[model samples]
Target chain A: AQSVTQLDSQVPVFEEAPVELRCNYSSSVSVYLFWYVQYPNQGLQLLLKYLSGSTLVKGINGFEAEFNKSQTSFHLRKPSVHISDTAEYFCAVSDYGSGNTGKLIFGQGTTLQVKP
Target chain B: DTAVSQTPKYLVTQMGNDKSIKCEQNLGHDTMYWYKQDSKKFLKIMFSYNNKELIINETVPNRFSPKSPDKAHLNLHINSLELGDSAVYFCASSQRTGNEKLFFGSGTQLSVL
Candidate 1:
């Protein structure tokens, strides 16, 4: 079984400041990584995913993440954040070897608070 | 045009009552799923259906049942609603299985009074 760990539960940042959300996973097989965002009382929205190709993946809203195979990490980073960027972020993983039936395993989630 | 929608955005009922939440995805995806988010904001997968066939059923209680009448719709019915069942339920859809990312509904807030 695969599991994910999000080191921090909350991250507070000022507007235009850079931020990073750490995520790590433990799985026996090859896995696909993803980042999702959720506003207050809303469902999750996919921000970015890492399937193949380059380790550095760029997502919407100027957010990006790098897949580190050696460190087993997929950390999300943004050079500058806006007030609108404040939301809950989740890191998820699915085993590629499990075929199409693979269900995503999500992290505990981190709440990003971007203030002015 | 909302890609995914769910009925009764808020549901309030007494304990022992039965309630149902309906979900529909206009994206024409073949796979759908139900996930629960507790007060602590922990997300857990409850069920998944592919082409109206049950594909994944997590360790959810038997009181909770998921029905997929068609590819674009999936509904959840909960019996004997308990305070512990009070949480936000989200519906999602994907074009394929593992490789596909999910599009989610706003969610239905269920409160057991």
Candidate 2:
């Protein structure tokens, strides 16, 4: 079984400040990583995904994440956040196998509250 | 145009009532899934269907049933609704091969009183 852990539930940061949301995963086999953002009462939208190739993956909305194989972590970071960036973020992982069904295992969401 | 659409975006019903939420995806994908988000905003996969064949069924209660008539439509029916069943249910779809990023619907917020 594969699972994802989002260490923080709520994070508060001032406008224009940098922030980071931590994510870690555990799987018996290789897996794919993705970040999704959810606005208030809205559906989840894909922020970015790490399939193969590079370790540093850039996503929409000025967000980026690093895929660290040694630590089994995919932490999301933003250089500067605005008030409009306040939203809930989720980290998900899917196994990399044929006929995987593409079912994603998601972590408890992390709410980013950007203050002015 | 809505890639994924779900009907009755907000549903409020009394306990013991039965309800159904319909979902349709126009992305021409062969796989669909249902996920539940609780009051605490924790997402859990309930079921998955690829080509209208059941592929993944989680440890969800039997009260919840998912039906897919074709590759583009998947619907969920619930029986004997309980207060614990109140949550936001999301419908998503993806291509069965190469590209696997899921496209999600706005969600149906079910409130069982």
Candidate 2 colliding pairs: none
* DockQ for candidate 2, C-alpha atoms: 0.66
Candidate 1 regions off by >4 Å? none
lDDT of 2: 0.94
Model 2 segments beyond 4 Å from truth? B97-99
Error of 2 at A7 (Å): 0.8
Among the numbered candidates, top DockQ falls to 1
Model 1, residue B19: displacement in angstroms?
A: 0.5
Model 1, range B1-113, lDDT digits (tens) per residue? 99999999999999999999999999989999999998888898999999999999999999999999999999999999999999999999999666698999999999999
> Candidate 1's residue-wise lDDT over A21-96, tens digit each?
9999999898999999999878899999999999999999999999999999999999999999999999999887
Q: Give DockQ per model, in order.
A: 0.76, 0.66
